[model samples]
Target: MLRRTVLLTFAGAALGGSLWQGAAHASEGRSPYGPLQPPDDVGLALPEGFTGRLVARSGHRVAGLAWHAAPDGGACFPDGDGWIYVSNSEIPLLGGASAIRFAHDGTVRDAYRILSGTNLNCAGGATPWRTWLSCEEAYRGRVFECDPYGSRPARPRLAMGRFKHEAAACDPDREVVYMTEDEKDGCFYRFRPTDWGDLTEGTLEVLCHGMVWKEVPSPAALVKATRHQVDDARHFNGGEGCHYADGVCYFTTKGDNRVWAYDAKASTLEPIYDADSPLSGVDNITGTASGELFVAEDGGNMEINVITPQRVAAPFLRLHGHSRSEITGPAFSPDGTRLYFSSQRGRRGILTDGHTFEVTGPFTI
Candidate 1:
């Protein structure tokens, strides 16, 4: 196994488990998990004090609908009695997003499809207004904003631009979104909405050298026209998972096995952690209620890497005995008590099936 790690010098002192050194957490003093326990029957290995449960499995009847195939990116949302986790399907042509509702006790009450008829619905991020921004990872791809509760129909947010979309992180305070692309030579983009919490229309731009912003007149065109036009200088090397934490947008590049932090306020992008050789294929990333970051691995042994407040990167959980699968969609409940994630390939290496599980334990902030 090849492993690579490089120390980065940020602007502030380390805060142990408080925040990401210089970056202040949007929320403070959140709880943290005590320890992780072995999986009961879920086929996962957790910390000594934590326990995991298989909530939904592909091909299983969840609620009235069959759990969607190839569960990819997902996010948790507040519900009446508990919460709902929306997952995207990465299958081409038939790809869509699905939702599973869990009670306050972590018992899943229902699961159903939210967005359908999309292509390669890969990883996505939750919006500030309780919506899921499902990104299609294909040429001429677009983003679909789907209501988590099924209160409204999922529609394509055309104004947000379209170009091999991967994932998005919304900064509600600034009413802007930071997005990642799946191409090896993709550009990092940001969408500034005309109205806060409204994603129907927006101005799309890409980050260039010197922290400069270049307008993308037609995102769909630039992606398919010259192909390398937008990737001339700022290619992110297979941009993958992304999430907005505190005031910074953190994302990963699978090709480089690096996680980067983009401070929208400073308009600067810098590496925070580089994986040791064995820790490659960084995928979907999310944060705990306490501001700690968790990143899923797309391949390499299928483990989830945790970044503590002190900026230490370490493996937190491993998909025991699973060799052909990768971990995706690492998300947390709104209250920060339970952690949710999915395995792209089934536990038994079944290509057509996947599983989603929840880990609950004593979490500290």
Candidate 2:
């Protein structure tokens, strides 16, 4: 059975006001604190014109986030107003099947417990067709497409395959979907749908990065050459966050902190960025309207790293300390005005619960 709860007021703050109005009162201008520090294992820091405050927390073991526009045109609330879907990877006794929903105002609106007996709800992405694709980052894991409204039943799109899927992105125009695997010798994958909007009966191919990585052959040959064998070997570390831009797709590897760009036409993967400073355990990523990329680093520093068009990553938003508040689930508002992200506070050794925050910024870079 699905367990659902709604909290219209959190920390004594009422809903229906601006996002920051209640947060300002609850925090009193003091930012949350953690034990880790920069240059070591610390938290995150914000830019000059930006500030981050906890909007909701302690609900469930939060993973990725998907923010949708409210039908009523109000600020993002947590009731059942605007849809804020989240992946609750695990609950102490609830086992593996669960996801949370919130109103635009930060209220605990409803909850759906689906696909029970699963684990490691790491991160997921939204589709252009308005469905949230939640990936299970465990051996022999699967991808599930959830309906935000809770009106439709949740099911897995098995054509996308069964593996340690970290993140996925869709191209509505071309009817193609890209996915990243979480393994040491992890390989990137592309799925071409038979129908433009349908995800059934498609071809899956792994990226082989050599001289032939750039060449394209029949879908059948491409799959066979990449050893597209669906096996039960569930240990590797090659995937994390991914996004599709223009005609290309970009993804990051948590094991190495390396970024790769895949050309759909060329059928090749090219190195984009590889920094040596901090272990780039990139968790989630999203592109801005201006074409810049924002990556959520889930390692030593709980910060959001910014990658410029020229492929340079600098400290974008620092969360102060490790505190286990690894940043994940980065998404821009439809208008690209505000940014939404989630923090999984207990994963990286922080002893706190998970939560979500919204950052208002006149982003420049």
Candidate number achieving the greatest TM-score relative to the actual structure: 1
Off by over 4 Å in 2: 1-44, 60-85, 88-117, 209-237, 346-352
Evaluate residue 280 in candidate 1 and report its C-alpha lDDT on the 0 to 100 scale. 59
lDDT of 1 at 174: 78
The ten-residue window of minimal lDDT in model 1 covers 25-34
> TM-score of predicted model 2?
0.69
Cα RMSD for predicted model 2: 13.6
- The estimated TM-scores of all candidates read 0.90, 0.69
> How well does candidate 2 score on lDDT at residue 229?
51
- Candidate 2 has an lDDT of 0.54
Q: Tens-digit lDDT track for model 1 on 1-365?
A: 64445434344422233434454322112123323355456677777678787777788888777887788999999998699999999888999999998888877788777899899999889987889999999888889999889878999998877678899999876788889888877888889988888888778888877788777767567535313555443777888988886667888998888888886666667777675633557888988656677888988878786776654566677787667888888888888888888887776776467888888766554
Give the Cα error of residue 336 in candidate 1, in Å.
0.4
Q: lDDT winner among the candidates?
A: 1
Relative to the true structure, how large is the alpha-carbon lDDT of every model?
0.78, 0.54
**Model 1, which residues run further than 4 Å from truth?**
1-3, 12-39, 222-233
